[model samples]
Target: PAPTAAPPEFLLNAPGTWNLPMRTALASLPRSVWLLGLVSFFNDTAGELIYPILPLYLASVLMAGPRVLGLIEGIAEATGSLLKLASGIGADRMRRSKPWIVAGYAVAGLSRPLLALAASWPVVLVLRFADRIGKGLRSAPRDALLGASVPAHQRGLAYGLHRACDNAGSVVGPLLAAALLARQTPLDQIFWWASVGSVLAVLLTLLIKEEPAPPRPSAPRPDWRPGALPPAFRRYLVVLGVFTLGNASNMFLLLKAKDAGMADYQIPLLWAVVSLVAAVFAAPLSALSDRVGRRRLISLGWAVYALFYLLLGLAGEGWMMWALFGFYGLFMAATEGAEKALVADLLPREQLGTGFGWFHLVSGLSLLPASLLFGSLWEAWSPLAAFGSSAALALLALVLLRRWVGLPAQDGR
Candidate 1:
């Protein structure tokens, strides 16, 4: 007997009809996203604990100054950018993401303990490089895994929830470090504790189930050259690259907070506030992109960032710094997840790893110069000059992006 298709009324009315089964299925979809979010939460908690303190450690403890900071960061980020591109291709060739993900975490986890033992600036430099290498290796594959695990309709939500969880960890990590520091815990001890959290993050990666590859209709052909992506994707990457050139390391932002009369202790608290705001808004704003459009949200986020940079440059008091930092979180919430979701929409499933790799590579590679430029401007001129210039570039990028790419409509899910 021939199988009967579903009735036209059932198919057509699916969105309007409040079916319990459909609702349950929709509810279940965000699960994998949330789980991955938990993993990111733990991982970022570990990262933030040390990341916020590293510059102080270098400047005061190791007697290194802004020059060393710029050199180390530039080298580490450049290495990471290249590795991100390579790891993407490797992940696609190996057809396994978990190993790369696990290895990356393990490497970073082990390096944190070494940071505890560093007695000199060079040692710290070496350890930072290792940590960033792990980051470079894992980032693309992990993102690819996350994208593959969820339905296309929910990519924004998935990436947003992940970013939110990651930022939530960022919020908690600094708070924990602050408490520990207040209790007179040694910096070395803090690094050791962060190492424990990193280990736990690596363990969690073991629990994520990779989706099986779809069976090929014929034997897979070897294609050493992965072709170019869609024109929209290429254009989007260019705009992102431009934006990243102005988006230097957050270390500069911390330095600005200090310069703006924030006490040493207050810096961490300000960062915590930023993280909390980002965590709270990330998921909702990302989900909003699904209904409206990613380009609009991303462009708005960039504009907000320009405003924050200007505010940071001009801020004179602690309260003003805090306000700008809080607003900075909103910028991240609007942009980060929506950017990735847009990439997923533009690229084919098989090319995801490469696409993400290139996306990250272009963005990450810009960081080295951006950081150097910001640091040099701060040293040679005023903090206001440095930040104002960055703000101007961001505003320019925003204008160009809007002109070059109109707001994209939601992809038909």
Candidate 2:
């Protein structure tokens, strides 16, 4: 027998809900949404434990410089971006996602231990590559799983909750790192603890159950035909790619804080502040997108990001750094989940993994050039010049997108 109609509670419409359309949308969210959120919470907490402090560790502990930082980040991100496409294809071909998901997480988890053993900058590079390879393999499949699990109406909320939990981990991980640093814990020890956290994330993945893959069409579809994507999706991707080109790695931001004369101990606190703010706003802004439409929120996010980069470049003091970082967190809250939700809206159910893979590939690939350009500009001119160039690019992208693509309709499915 067909599954029974969802209970009234699950029907999305309920009395006194503030936004009836959004409420109806929320009602359709799947249990997998929250479960995946938990998985991200743990995984990102582990990832964040090392992420915020990585550049600092390279410079202070390993005695590397900006050029090396650029190379390492550029290579890692570029590799991961290519892998996103490969993994997506693999998932589609295998007709299985969970196994790849599990393998990816396991590889990432294992890579953390190697970080604990790194003896030189080159060793750190290898470990970072390994970790990112795991990220590259898993991100598309995991996102596809989330997209598959949720109803069309609630994609934003589902993606938002996932970002919230991921950002919440960002909050906790930095705090934990700060505490560990304060205790004079060795950097290797911190990596070891992060490895343990990754293990927990892998364990949680066991609990997640994906929906069966959709059956393929019997007739062969034409390859690369015109109107391949719904007009809305293609427009959205173009806009998103433009926005990402200017959104370089957070390492630059951290390095900026350090350049402002903030002590080593203070860096993690600043990151914690950013992550905390992101955690608070991610869900609400995502929920808001369910009402106001994701395009508007995304445009707003790009505008905010542009402003923050400009401020970071100009700000000369610690307090200004703190303020900018907080606002930066808000920018992340506005964009990350909304971006994922937009991708879900654009693609068909059967092609979710491929769509997400392509999405990750586009965004992730940009990081290489973004990071290299930022670093080279810093080395050649000044940090201000580097940041100013990125901000200008972002503004231009935002303008072009607004003029050309415009916003998608928000009918809540």
- Cα lDDT listed for each candidate: 0.78, 0.77
TM-score, every prediction: 0.90, 0.90
Global Cα lDDT for candidate 1: 0.78
Model 1 per-residue lDDT at 316: 79
Expressed as tens digits, the lDDT of each residue in 1-413 for candidate 2 is 11324423222232123466555655556767777788788988898899877887899889988778877887787788778767876776666778778878888889976777877899988988988899888888888888777665466677877888998999888888889989999888888888767988899888877777756768444222215556766665666667667777788889899989998878988998888888877766776666667677877988998999998898888778888899999888888888788787667665667777778877777778888888889999999998998898888877866677644454332
lDDT at residue 135 of model 1 (Cα atoms):
86
Model 2 segments more than 4 A misplaced: 1-28, 221-232, 406-413
What 10-residue stretch in candidate 1 is worst by lDDT?
7-16
> How far is each candidate from the true structure, as Cα RMSD in Å?
5.1, 4.1
